[model samples]
Target: MPQSSNVPNGASAAPKAKYNRPKPVVLAVIDGWGVAPHWGGNAVTLAKIPFMNKAMQEFPHTTLQASGEGVGLPPNERGNSEVGHLNIGAGQVVLQYFPSITKAIQDKTFFSNEVILQGINQAKQNGKRVHIIGLVSPGGIHSHIEHLYALLEVAKQQQFTDVCIHAITDGRDTPPFVSQEFLADVTTKTQELGVGSICTVSGRYYSMDRDHRWERVEKSYRAMVEGVGPTAATPEAAVAAAYRDGFSDEFIPPTVIQGPKNTFKPIMDGDTVIFFNFRGDRAREITQALMKPNFEGFDRKKSVSNLYFVGFTYYEEGLPIHVAFRPHNVKKSLSGVISDAGMRQLHVAESEKYAHVTYFFNGGNEQPVKGEDRIVIPSPHVPSFDQVPEMSTVQIADTVIQNINRYDFIVLNFACPDMVGHTGNLRAAIQSCEAVDANLNKIAQAVAQAGGIFAITADHGNVEQMVNPKTGEPDTEHTNNPVPFIVTGNAVVNCQLRSGGILSDVAPTLLHILNIPKPAEMTGSSLLVVQPQVARSAASTL
Candidate 1:
């Protein structure tokens, strides 16, 4: 890639510092690792993580608030990879789309949104059916049951009798068997509102695939628009039968529901669709299958004309779809600042989490900045991550180590712990922790050899707590926990890290060590506790 002198719009000039340091800074984000007080169900405590354990004792470390308001999510909401990476790179609290959509509903602005109204009114005027689709869970990680209800309410208010919901069950973000309760809740709410019926059902594994799994996405598309799947009497029956057939909520095969007149209601030519998912990553592939005119992912089998598709938020740039709420603008990101300073940066991760290290970590910029290099390792194509517990961590570590001397800053993510942790298998989660630890030790040694600084932290908590304390059941959901931040290597000999910090502080601290000035747009301060003598000396020299 050719380097350019043009800087991003919001990027500011990073003035050269008086205190010069030649060694690079490496940030390793150990996803799904968190600190907990209990021993039971705590995989991090149960597993052997020699590198992490020693770093905590030998380095300047502190616990950071990664969940809820600290990461700009709704109060009490658990932190997710999306918001976690955004906060870590933006150096400020980047408000998430969930709270904005919730507030829109609360203030009665949701119903009047132009894109939503256009889809609903067009369907109503054409005497065509309106279809709402999304994950039917209260997990708040991707889609919420409440957001689905709000869209259903729009149908009720518009008096569109021909309304249907395409439900996608979630097991990774919620309890494995809790889909029944969520489907029941949606059924009751639609009944109370006197509108809409569940017309199709599928698991998120088929509908929410982000790994270019065309087969899985095609299954969901055919079920929703072509009615090419097993028939069920009702949504409840579909989930019950799946459970009986030894299929968990996440792996339920796509099934079409039979209507009152003993017929299936496939989406028609003039029908409209509204996907009510707030997050974008898992929703992008399915959205493309539904809305893209020239989609070549798989054969559609049947194509509907004049179908107006609306997404809850922007899935990708330049897609032929309308968005209900646009993303919050994030400027002067850490990557942008580094680029403006003419530093070489490398972002490496497996396909499972490649977007986190680049897109989300760069403040939603899909294109890389000048002097930025990205490497994406292919993840395994297993049915579940537990089958391949490591999931390419060794490859990622090798890539990072090989390029440590070439880049001024390197950002890497290990997807094993978080991806396997979602399976609710304690043994697999433990193995993942061990895998990450072993490779992490290698990367740290290589960084030390390069005479650079090594920083370690996590996005949120998952592998830490495997089982629910109340019911003693396997819990796959993220916890409202704080993650650890540890800094080791030559740059910080006697430096003291601040006691309390959040994910946003990570970027500022890196800039501080690099001797780069933080942009004015960054609200986060450095977590490095500068001694009085050193501070005064630096100030006098400046």
Candidate 2:
């Protein structure tokens, strides 16, 4: 809410006034594109990305560290879109939710969290069940298996015996067929701790749909609350049945696991539900279905009264739920600074990554600022992105091109490379990259014609490394690789880009190009190498 145009950070002091600052600066985030070491499974290297390759050579370009500490994740942790966009918008390293939760657990703070304790105590006092729901994976993109384990430990310590885990299998951030292994691990941990049971199993496709897919949300919701899905004798049996039905971990239909005496455990009245996903984008829709009394997404067969809801982190602003770990406040974001300057901006992306452009890119702020425009192209409703490697890039590019000259700043995300790269199909990944490159060329040309500056970068790495070097198998996980940052246009014709920059520097760099002083809260320095005389002469022309 703080919107002062005063520049407080000396790190972002105004450059010399002589640069030809272009209007309508465009920041195109080529999701999942990275600079790889070798061509081994590297889609960016094998793909026909002529524009990106030529721009890197011809323009002021640099490789930015996108993973681990650079984006404020744990050491060596592969960066995800959430943290990547947050850092890019904030113009500073924003500590992510994963590390904060991990630290809480390590220091015994998690067990004593007031919100978590309240949920457990409510369940115990009411003599009702406590339900833990989240994506069951070690990938750490959205939810981590370790965090689930820690929640179970909390249940045990609190003497809440009746507990159920609604496991949501993941294949995008993890291997396609590793759900059985993760379920087995969860079972062992629960047995050892003498707490909780895996009562229901589903895939992220059903449980974590953020694209307003009401049917998918209804499927997962009904399976947990109404017990309206297939039944299996055990959690392992449920996952095995899904595999036998030719379903991968991500598309596994919701199945209710049988409890004692051949009974199913559906969420009932007076139940306390704790959603354990640390990240919020995918978790928002499902949380709304469970907690919102006036929920209109899908008709629930029956409403469970007196249901208590809790979330690992705040899913959105003004959501009626308790948060075990609140989000960190990110002040003076790139969008905030631009809005304060009374500049018009546009944020565009497909449904697959709409949140990245607007929500995460605004430093966790959900609402749009003054003069901010948002356009979301509907993504394909296919089972796998590999099937449609060009996921809405053409439409997004069309939108950007049509509105190129209307806004002072434009931000768009091309989600093809990242979404398709998760399918572990190198050929499809290459095709996705090419599709993005083709469309990106069109936008770049439009921006050039408008006499505007455009910067091409990425949130993280996925399509770049498709195969695991050690086992030579398909690797669907995000890589801890650096992404390329290329600036193009007449404004920065002879400018030198600083080396050793990270995603956090992008915002400041854009501000510097616009001749705007970076906010005090922005710790990152501009990536533009400034020359006083040249900058001065350029500004005089403008």
Candidate 3:
């Protein structure tokens, strides 16, 4: 296993000369908050959000390009949590997984990749079934269906007879009613090839979990192991039932489809499971469920013995795994710079997005920094986030208040708007915005009480533009819109952001506020109105 440290080479990872710690900096990333015209369809504009509104009117604020090529996505592509958070934390534009994976597939490199071939060869040697599992969506958030197609094609070429697919349904990023269609297409494709079968099906909400949500994982385990939850005569019936029950296609509970000869096919021992999702956040826990023996996070009832598991890529460099593709190596993130500058950092976020503030924000490294304080608040456990739009906002605010003065730098992620936005509930989305507003008031005051600076921004746009212009109905997908970037409070730096700033610029700006030089590899420039003392003093007389 390769070891990674936040402290760059030739630089001290801790404080050498306590160079007058500046005022505490409170940086908040309000998930899904965006800038849109004040209209009925705009949730943020329609909601009664006093704090964010006041910041727009009084604080040093500007528009940041959060989606598309602005954040290293393909032209006109919407930004997702994985790329958005990675870019924000890296202080540079990290190429997104979708485009990179697409390129590899187009170039035929992924099909013959050593890691994937190794998995197939090992399966053949051990006389085991090679089972592929991941999110079944083209939304480009988790795993895309195209990746599945490539894997199935490879399986056919290799003449693998014992192949299965466990699809994690998705409706959050795409339309809310397309899981059945997706499954049908995959089932038909696999049948035509005569290589793989759709063995198990469930929603990503239950299987793709972070923050130690064991119950959700157990639900997935039951669906695969015991045919628990809803049962359908066929995949088509299950999709219809999911819609009839008023649940989104993505949030559909675990359902099992009857296999040939009218039998329930469950995942058993000697099965090699490969998670095809390139992004790591949600894939981590479920992958562990299959890979780790004596896994205490959740009880799988029976021991899933002698199972060979692999991820599309080993997400965290610290944890080694046999994977198919090469995961992007994100280095020299803001966390490393902060650690090298010898700043005490606190990362606070609810379970829904805790990894974004800690793991992703630290350049995809899972291990904690030498002097980092991390707090994860559990989100509400419900079928849907709209059930509780005000999800953990108060708890997050309370955490900030309690630890405001303990750390020099506090990074927080509020996950209401984004999580609820995916539910396509206009009322709930508005309420989520209002909830974020109320908590922002509490948090900003806490930052002021601690004599710190408060900087607020968003990963991407979701609740901002609620309605689709064409259909005039609630649009659940994230919008390709600019987000607000505001800086306020006593510790505010005398700085103005350059024109056309993007998410990557945030890390550099935050480091500048703390009197740290940007790493050489960081492509974004600091958006501060003035440069640091070393340069400011030189220019004083010039």
TM-score of each: 0.94, 0.94, 0.90
Which residue pairs does candidate 2 place in steric collision? 18-535, 18-536, 18-538, 18-539, 19-535, 19-538, 19-539, 20-538
Q: What is the lDDT of candidate 1?
A: 0.86
Clashes of each: 0, 8, 2
Off by over 4 Å in 1: 1-19, 259-263, 533-542
The CA lDDT of each predicted structure is 0.86, 0.87, 0.78
Measured on C-alpha atoms, candidate 2 has an lDDT of 0.87
Q: Candidate 2 at residue 382, lDDT?
A: 85
Q: How much is the lDDT of residue 210 in candidate 2?
A: 88
Give lDDT tens digits, candidate 3, residues 165-236.
Answer: 777888778877778889889878877888777766788778887757788888888877677777776676
Per-residue alpha-carbon lDDT of candidate 2 for residues 1-542, written as tens digits (9 for 90 to 100)? 11112212321222223323587799999898888876779988898989988887788999999999999999999999998999999999999999999999999999999988899999899888999999999888998999999999999999876888999999888878889999989989888998888989999999999888999999999999988889998888888999999988998999998856235678888899999999999999988888888989999887776778899998987678888887889979999888777677788888888889988999888888766777778888887789999988888888888888777789999998998988899999999999999988998899999988989999999888999888888888898999999999877877889899999999999998887888899999999885997687657533
Report lDDT (Cα) of residue 62, candidate 2: 93
Error of 3 at 467 (Å): 2.9
- Give the higher-lDDT candidate: 2 or 3: 2
Q: After TM-score superposition, what is the CA distance of residue 228 in candidate 2 from its true location, in Å?
A: 1.9
